[model samples]
Target: MKTNYQREITKHIETNQLSYLFIMILFIVGLIFGAMIVVSMHFTQKQDLLFYLNQYFSRIDQQEILNHFDLFKSALFSHLQYLIIFLLLGLSIIGLPIIWVTIFIKGTFIGFSVGFFVYQYGFSGLLFISAAILPQNLIVIPVYLFAATIAMIFSGQLLKKLSGRRFIRFTVEPVSQYLIVFVVLFGFCLLAALIEGYLIGYYLPLVRQLIN
Candidate 1:
């Protein structure tokens, strides 16, 4: 016999699967929009980006000019901004549209980042993914997706509350559970931030060396 915990987990998964799918589809749309913008840009612009990339990498290797600490700070700040947006959307009652927008913006950012990298570096840009995006994003994207889905789910429940379909008793358990979920997801975001700060810098030099 399945325990109550097991059944609850299964039920949540089944219930949220469609919502997750809907969010992912929106992300895909955003990702495509981002890539399209890069694709349609002028060749001169692409060359400029290529030149800047080469110059930046040369500085990193020969001059040791890139401040890893500053890079980490920037990366962490960027990530925390993402985290805060999703967290707020997930916890708020009327945040579904914003959540979708966040998904699109995130997709656009990644699509542009990856697309521009490839456009500038050609085959070599693929190597940059190993160091730059692959590591942190591997953890971060899934967490964002989960957080978004949870936000949508919560928003739906809140709608039900408004309609007098459920939670009419004003119980503390549900609110406490929502807070606990946020705490756990925040901790996960911190973990991703640590990886961005410490590990990604180590990967960058190695990846650049291999690609060059």
Candidate 2:
């Protein structure tokens, strides 16, 4: 009996998977926008960082270099925070369009940022993006996906319960499932942010210079 119940719940979850798919589709759409931005910016913003590098190297000053690094790190972290919060709020809402718009906007920002780099450095820009952006995304994308899934399930459960529909008791199971997924998503966000801030922020500059 317990096994059968669990099977039913799993089936329900699977059936509702389309909610998650919608969000993912939005995310890919956003990524396309972001990539375009990166490509556009690459052409417009390409400057031989050599001059800037020479200027900084000539000064041979640790404090100024560290300051610039701090500024870049802060900017990166701020962007990450903004993206996470925007997506979280969007997913928490009860409408499909709201979620879709939010995901597209997020993807646009990402696409533009990456596209800017690609336009500037070509394949090297791609490398920079993979190093700088990909690490955090590994965690963030899945987190948002789970959040969207939970939000969808929660909304469905609420509707069914309120409608005085049959099988109202089944709503509790989905609610519990939503809560669990939310917790996991939150945890992944934290881990992703740390990796972005410390590993990528601290090390990427050195890596870039070394390669150059």
User: Which of the numbered candidates is closest to the native, going by highest lDDT?
Assistant: 1
Model 2, C-alpha of 37: deviation from truth (Å): 4.7
- Per-candidate Cα lDDT values, in order, are 0.78, 0.62
lDDT (tens digit, per residue) of candidate 2 on 50-160: 356457544433334444346446645654564455444533435445556766887787777676656656788688778867888877767666665555555554655
29, model 2: CA deviation in Å? 1.5
Poorest stretch of ten by lDDT in candidate 2: 59-68
Q: Per-residue lDDT tens digits of candidate 1, residues 1-212? A: 99998998799989789998998999888889988989899989878877888898887677475466776677767766876776677667789899888888999989888888776667788778766778778887887888888878887787778888455766788768766776777677777777776777666667787557
Q: Would you estimate the TM-scores of all the predictions?
A: 0.85, 0.65
Clashes of 1: 0
How many residue pairs clash in all the candidates, one count each? Answer: 0, 16
Where model 2 places Cα greater than 4 Å from the true spot, the runs are 1-13, 37-95, 160-176, 210-212
Measured with C-alpha atoms, the lDDT of residue 85 in candidate 1 is: 76
Task: Tell me the lDDT of candidate 1.
Answer: 0.78
